[model samples]
Target: MPYFDSERFASLLEKEGFSASQAKAVINALNDVVDESTVNVTDDLITKEEQQKTIERYKNDFRQLKTDIQRMEKNDVEDVKSANERLKADIDKLKKTLQDELIRSQAGVRLDLNLEKGRIRDETVEQHDRLKNTDEKIANEIQALKTQMQGIKMQILRYMIGTITGAGTLVLGYIHFSH
Candidate 1:
């Protein structure tokens, strides 16, 4: 608040060539306006100390939030790592199971193939025996035909000699009778 004296202001105004009554009226009006005026101090304007404390409080809250977020992120990473481990274990077990089944199936197929091969070999052996017997029978028949051919040649030779001797005897008898 500013303090002023009406006497001094009016006296100064009178020295500046104003009439005393005019000076007094002007001073009185000035005083009336001052007294009627008002100055307000609202809470919108903060003190320096209050502003510094609020800034520090906000800084602390931001730091705590950052720590909380980091902790959550670390938990999420651990969860993912553990899940991956479980999945890897499952995949390994599945691979082993599939490999075992494949080995068993292969062994079964091999056993079947060996059995079939043995059966085919037995059939071939039986067929070979039948063909051998047939060949022996044909050989015996050819030998019998050779022996019969030799007997026929001997009988033809004997018949040709007897016919020659009878013709010679008939010629001798005819000559004697004619003479």
Candidate 2:
């Protein structure tokens, strides 16, 4: 406790030119003086009333230290609670931020889908219109072809009637002349 290593003390004394025996004797003498002083001081300090007083002082100090420790523990608990509350708040804020971002992305996706649906509907309507126009054109073409076919059929029937009339007239004239 007092930085007195015996070997170091002896070596230091020898370094100062004391022979080994002188060094050992000096160290011994110093030890005896120190021990006597310590004994006298300890005897004075160990009286019954003084010892009781010292014990009472130590007890009081121990109680004070216990109170301080309890106070420090209470303060530490409060600090931990406050830190937890702050951490919870931060987590809640982060959750809200993530939720908001998610909602925004969802809305963006919905908007995109709606726009795509509109475009698809417009294309469908345009294709339907084209189909309708094509159908009407095909119907008109069919009607025109039917009219041309009927006209050609009537011309052929007229030519056949004219040829049959000429043949019947020649047969009648021949029979009358022969009779």
Candidate 3:
């Protein structure tokens, strides 16, 4: 079943010449007074609850038919003859109802599947874009870190060279003075 948004319904009612407040009041009343169980099946509108009940009833009938079939298979000749006839009739009725309900349920299933698929696709695209942007930011940060590390390494090398030269000069001066 399609989602029912009260705001959208009210907007539609207002567009049809009802005052905003009046539209809201009417929509509220409609929501309060509508009894799904009391709906007439012959009418064009099938409430969600009614459809669900029908599907459940069909499922139950099908289960009973299966049980009956099992019983017939285990019975004596006389019992089998009578039970088989009843089983056949019950099976036929259950089959017909099940087929009809299956078709109806399939229609709802198809609609739900389409909506879910669209939602999934949209989320996937959004996630892909977010990941791409994040990856680019990380890559830029990594490059900046590499440059800073190289600069720090160069500074350390310069300090080490200066220290080594100063030590060697001091040693030579001491040896020359002692001689």
Candidate 4:
């Protein structure tokens, strides 16, 4: 994956009163945490797929078990009632175990997904804040430059007017004195 520009991010953070090293550390921590959490989600997805396959295989096995139990109840000899009861209890226990495993797997997936989303949200907010601050700083700098340029222009205009007025007065004086 492409890494973010930590130097730039650190500089921005520094502007908000964080020390340079502290800013860098913060950026590094954010990147590490996000990457680690995202990787965890990826792992969770793989585990979830495996769990689903396991559940499917168990479902097939449970079906076969049910068929076997039914056949034993119908055709088996003495203690048929007790055998049926035991088989039913075993099936119920297996179902409960599968259900619990499924719930746990689903919950793990959801928790991982939620953490990934939260990390993304935090990064986005931080980026937006940095961008906003940068924009404001640039705007202020531009305004200051504009003000300085305007002042220079005004001074240049005044100098030009004064020079023209002085020349005109000198010309009129020479003409009057000669005539």
- Clashing residue pairs, backbone N/CA/C < 3 A, model 4: none
* Whole-model alpha-carbon lDDT for candidate 1: 0.66
Candidate 3 C-alpha lDDT tens digits along 26-109: 987877666443354437787899999999999999889767754544353345346556755765685577567657755655
Q: Candidate 4 residues 1-179, lDDT tens each?
A: 67678788888999999998898789889999989998998875757788899999999998887777556544533354455467557656855775676577557656755665566577877765665565566567557756765785576567556655755665565456445
Which of the two, 1 or 2, has more lDDT? Answer: 2
Model 1 misplacement above 4 A: 1-42, 123-179
* Candidate lDDT (C-alpha), each: 0.66, 0.69, 0.66, 0.68
TM-score-superior candidate, 2 or 4: 2
Q: Over 4 Å off in model 4, which ranges?
A: 1-12, 44-49, 77-179
Candidate 2 off by > 4 Å: 1-45, 120-179
Best by lDDT: 2
Clashes of 2: 0
TM-score against native, each model:
0.47, 0.42, 0.30, 0.32
All candidates in order of lDDT, best leading: 2, 4, 1, 3
Q: What local lDDT score does residue 92 receive in model 4, on the 0 to 100 scale?
A: 69
16-95: candidate 1 lDDT, tens digit per residue: 99999999899888877766663223335678899999999999998887777667556755665575567557656855
Error of 1 at 138 (Å): 47
